[model samples]
Target: MGTCACLRVRGGIRLSRVQHNKGERSTLMKKYLATACALCMGLGVAQASQITVINSEAASFVGVNSNESLGDPSNVVMNWTFTGGFNANNVHISGNLTEVLTGTFASEADIFATLPSGTLDIDQSSTGNYTGTVAVSTDVSIATPVDPAGNVSFEFYESFNDGAGTDQIWDDITIEFQEIGIQNGMVNLGALPSDGSLVTYSGHNVAGGLDFFDFSIGGPGVGAAGSYLNAQTIDPVTGDTIDTEIGLFDSAGVLVAFDDDGQDFALGGLYSMLSFGVDDPLTGSDTTPGADGATLAAGDYTLVVGGYDTNFEDLTIGVSTLADVIAGTSAGDYDLQLSYVPEPASLMLLGFVGMLGLRRRR
Candidate 1:
C-alpha cells in the first residue's frame, strides 16, 4: 500500500479539444486521431501500457514480495487463508479489483433501497467458515470468468497476520478465481490470487501519507468515474510497520476514503483497499468505515498512508479530517503499491495512430 503511493504523477494534465465538431466529431474522428497521433509522436509523448493479465495465476505473496524474508519464497506462504477456526478467504477482493480494471462495477445495495438490484443470499456452507456466493458476471457487458454472473462462491475471512513472525504489508491484490462452467449447482473453485506485480518505489508518504496529484477518468472535467486505490502495510522485520491504511482526499482536502485493512480478503485483511467509484458514496457518510469497504469520487485527490495500533473507525464523512485518521496510527514506514488503467483519452489518440498507419500501408 505505501510503496504504490510512492509513485509520482508526471506534472499536470494538458489536453486540447476541438469545439467545432461536438456533434459531428464522429465524422472527423479519423482526421483528428491521425493529426493528434502525429503531434504526439513529434512531441515524444510515449503511450502508457494498459494491463493484460499476464499469468493465469497471480504471483504468490512470495512471487511479488520476495524482498521480505530474504528472498526465501517458502517463508511467505498463502497458509493464512484461514484464521481462528474460520475461513479467512478474501478471494472476493481479488474479484473486485479485476472488475474495476475491466471497467465494471459490482453493487451490493442496502436492503432498504427502493428497488434493490442485488439479492442477500449467502451459501454459508458452514456456520463457522462463513461461506457465500459473490457477484461475478460474464452475463453483463463485461463477462467474468464465471458463466451465469452471480454464481460466485466467496468465503469472507477475518484476515490476520500469517503468524510467521514476519511483519508484512499487502498491496494492490488483483484476485481471480477459476471458472467451473455453469451455475445452478455452485461448486467451490480455487483462487488464482493475482496480486499485481509488487515492485517497490522509493520516496513515498509525506510524514504519514503517500501523496500524489492527477486527473480523473475523462481527464480534466471528469472525476475518477470508476477508480480505486488499495493499500496494505507489510514488512518481514517486526520493527517495520505491519498494519498500514490509506485515505483518499479530493482537491478540497476532505477525507473521501479511508481503509485500515483491505477487504481482509488476503493477509488477514489487515491491509486497506478503498474504491473511488462515482456511484459509491463518501466514507464517514457510510461511516461504517475501515476494511468493511468505503468509496470516494475518483479524481485529482490526495492519498494519506500511515500505520496504526488497532482498527479505528473515526473517519466519518463530515467529521474526520486528514489528521484525525493518521494521528491514531503509530509512526512506521509506509509501503505503497498501486494498480491503474491507462488514460482512455491518451489511448484514443494513440489507438487511432495504429489504425491509420495500417490503412496507409494497405
Candidate 2:
C-alpha cells in the first residue's frame, strides 16, 4: 500500500467547515444543492456494499447486491479474488457448472420450491493468491416467514463437478456485484434526479422477467411528503405497448401497494401510476387500497415492474414469474417514471383562472 496527499473527497462535503457569508444563507440552500447535485453526478449513486467469504458447503461465488433492487434481471459479474496461497506447484485451476439456476427475491429464506443443488467441488494445488469469477444472475430469493429484513436474499452457487480438493487458504476472498456500494439494502438508481424534476428509468428485462428499484419516500430529492410514479411497457420500435404492472413495498419489504390496469392514459390503462398524496384510492394499489396517499413520510420503498400478469406473490405455480416468463407470459422492456405531479392547490388555481376567463368572455 502507498500514501499521498491528494485531493480528498472524504465521504461528502462538510459545509460547516467552509463557511460563507451569513447573508448568503438564503441562497445557499438552492445554490448548495446545485453544487451538491453536480458532485453527486461524479461520485455516483450506487448503494454501499460489502462482501464476505463464506465457508458454506456451497463453495460457489457470493456477491453483494449493492444498488440493485430485487427483481432486476441484469447480469452481474461476480469476481472472486483470494489473498491466501494454496499448497502446491505446477497447479492448474479451472471449473465449470452442470447448469444454471436463477431467482428473484423480496427477502431471505425462500419458501418456494427449488430443485436440489449440490456444492461445487474444487480441488486445486495452486501456487499464489488466486482470483476467479463467474457471470451469474441469481439462484433463488429468500422471502418473509423465512429470513429477517436487511439480510441479503439470494446467492449464486454454481456447482463444480470436477475434483475434490479444498486446500485453498482464503482469508480475504472478495466478490463484487457491479462494483457498486451496498447500503442497508437501499438502491440508488443512477439516473434518479435530485433537482425535483421528472426522471424516467428505462429498463429491459434482458432476461425478460421482472425488474425492481428501491428508493426512499422522504429521502433527498424525493421528499417525505410523498411522491408520484408511473410505469409504461413499451415496444419502442413498434410504438404499440403492452400492459405493465407495478408493486410497492415499504422498508420492511411488505407488499403494501400494487397496481394492475392503472395509470390514466389517452390510449387506455395499460400504464401504471401512483401518487402518494394526490391520486384517489381507486387509482392506486389494487392489492392494498390503503396504499393510496400513504407514501408521505421519511422511509424507504421499493418498486417492482413486471410482466403484465406478474403479481406480488410466491411460486404456488413453480418458480413463479421466472417460469411464467419462460413459458412466455410476462416479460418485456418497460419504463419507470418518478416525479411530483401537480398539487391540488395548483389545480384549483388553474380552475379559478378558467372560470374568470369564461366570465370575461361572456
lDDT of 2: 0.37
Candidate 2 residue 232 Cα shift, in angstroms, is: 6.1
- Candidate 1 per-residue C-alpha lDDT over 247-308 given as tens digits, one digit per residue, 9 for 90 to 100: 66556765565666553333333445554333222222322222223233334545555445
Model 1 steric clash total:
32
Predicted structure 2: clash tally: 17
Off by over 4 Å in 1: 1-239, 263-265, 277-298, 309-319, 323-326, 342-350, 357-362
Q: On a 0 to 1 TM-score scale, where does candidate 1 land against the true structure? A: 0.32
Compared with the true structure, the alpha-carbon lDDT of candidate 1 equals: 0.31
Question: TM-score of predicted model 2?
Answer: 0.36
* TM-score of every candidate: 0.32, 0.36
